[model samples]
Target: MPLSEHEQRMLEQMERALYAEDPKFATALEGSGLRTYTRRRVYQAVAGIVVGIALLMTGVIVPNVLWVSVVGFLVMLGCTLLAVTGWRKAPKPGEQPVSGSAGGSAHGRNRQRRSMMNRIEERWQRRRDEQGH
Candidate 1:
């Protein structure tokens, strides 16, 4: 269920309090926004497309060198795919929860830490198995 306006305000106030008390921890708890493709990603994709277009023009000017443009276009396409699909993959299951240390309820903090540790251990075990160590 969505938080009511009052609850949202309260949460915001709590976040501010946490930020005031400890900026480092608060910033970490703020977590990334839900949407994908940050401004940098979008800018990079735009730059890639522009470069590809430039390469295409260069290829057209030089006879029998269409591969330059083709490669550029492919790279541009790959960047576009990375900007779109690559950004949306959710955090793996049982990842850490976002809760400011000072603001989180006791049970919430415990659960979050436990989940985070479990994920770390699972990843470590996977690496060990893969390396035959």
Candidate 2:
């Protein structure tokens, strides 16, 4: 979901405050999104694999075209490897927990809430199981 205008303004204010309080820390946190190289790597890998398959097909159908298939296969292999490695290292897309005390407290509360809901669900299930209907 997109942020409301109010939320956007609030976030901007918070960011400004963070910058004012500690410019170094704020800068460190900035621009931490996934690197562009990783996206390119994935795209390259998929294209390589597709081209490789096409080349292999052509080589099989035409005489004296084995080299084309060989080159394609190598390209595909290299691209696949690059993509896999890049994707593995990329950060997941989501709001990361804030650093420091609030983060820990928020995480703890979330866990507690999950546990309570689980217990409630289990109790309801047990009651249903006990009933003949």
Candidate 3:
């Protein structure tokens, strides 16, 4: 079931409270932070790619070592790919969840999660109301 507006507000409030009470734990649960590509990291990646190319060349020149050259080439390709697009920006620990592009898979996933959360929240609200009565 979808959450009513009041219930959504309540949930958001609870989330804020949880974040306030245990920011460290909340951050940890948010998962690893994005790896910012620094100048040093770029340099290292370039060095690794160069080494891989050198190894590949050596393997190609050496008799009976075509496999070594293949491995080196694969390593070079992997490094290049990683350098180009290894990581994306993870959502900041305390920031609101970002909605994905309209009608995307991410939207679907978020919708499913929201509905499940609403079900849980409804149960909680029912118990609260019962206790108050």
Candidate 4:
């Protein structure tokens, strides 16, 4: 959902205050560099895999060029590894739901769902109170 004007203004004010207090820390929190690096790495890996496929096909078509296919296979393997590692290392954005102490069991999920529902109910109640007032 989009932020209300008042909420947006408050958020902007808080952001300005944060910037004034600690510009470097706020900038570091942006995290664009890590995202960009991960994207670039994945793209490069995909390109490498495509090139490897072409090489493999070429080697197979040509007689007595087994080395090309072997090299292509190795390249594909390396690129696959690179892509997997890059994706794994990338940080997930947004708030993650807290799991219960018992790990991610059905009970944990139920609790989380109930908490979210309670929050929604509280918000609805507050809105009703405000409208009534």
lDDT tens per residue, model 1, 1-133 = 9999999999999988988999877765544542232555677778888887888788888999999888878877877886685344322323343335545556666998999999999999999999996
The global C-alpha lDDT for each of the candidates, from Candidate 1 onward, is: 0.71, 0.75, 0.72, 0.82
The candidate 3 region of ten consecutive residues with least summed lDDT is 31-40
**lDDT tens per residue, model 2, 75-122:** 778778878876764544432423455577567669989999999999
**Winning candidate number (TM-score):** 4
Model 4 scores what on Cα lDDT?
0.82
Residues 1-133, candidate 3: write the lDDT tens digits.
Answer: 9999999999889878879999877765554442333343566668879989998998989999998898889888887776664332234454333345536646757998999999999999999999999
In model 2, the runs with Cα more than 4 Å from the true position are: 32-34, 60-67, 89-133
Badly placed stretches (over 4 Å) of model 4 are: 1-14, 88-133
Please give the TM-score that candidate 1 achieves against the real structure.
Answer: 0.42
Give candidate 3's error at residue 58 in angstroms: 0.6
Clash pairs of candidate 2?
Answer: none
The TM-score between candidate 3 and the true structure equals: 0.38
Badly placed stretches (over 4 Å) of model 1 are 1-37, 90-133
Q: RMSD of each candidate?
A: 12.6, 10.1, 15.4, 10.4
Give lDDT: candidate 1, residue 87: 49
Per-residue lDDT tens digits for candidate 4, residues 16-107, read: 99889998877766667667767888899999999999989989999999899999999999999999977765544422323334355557
For model 4 the TM-score comes to 0.50
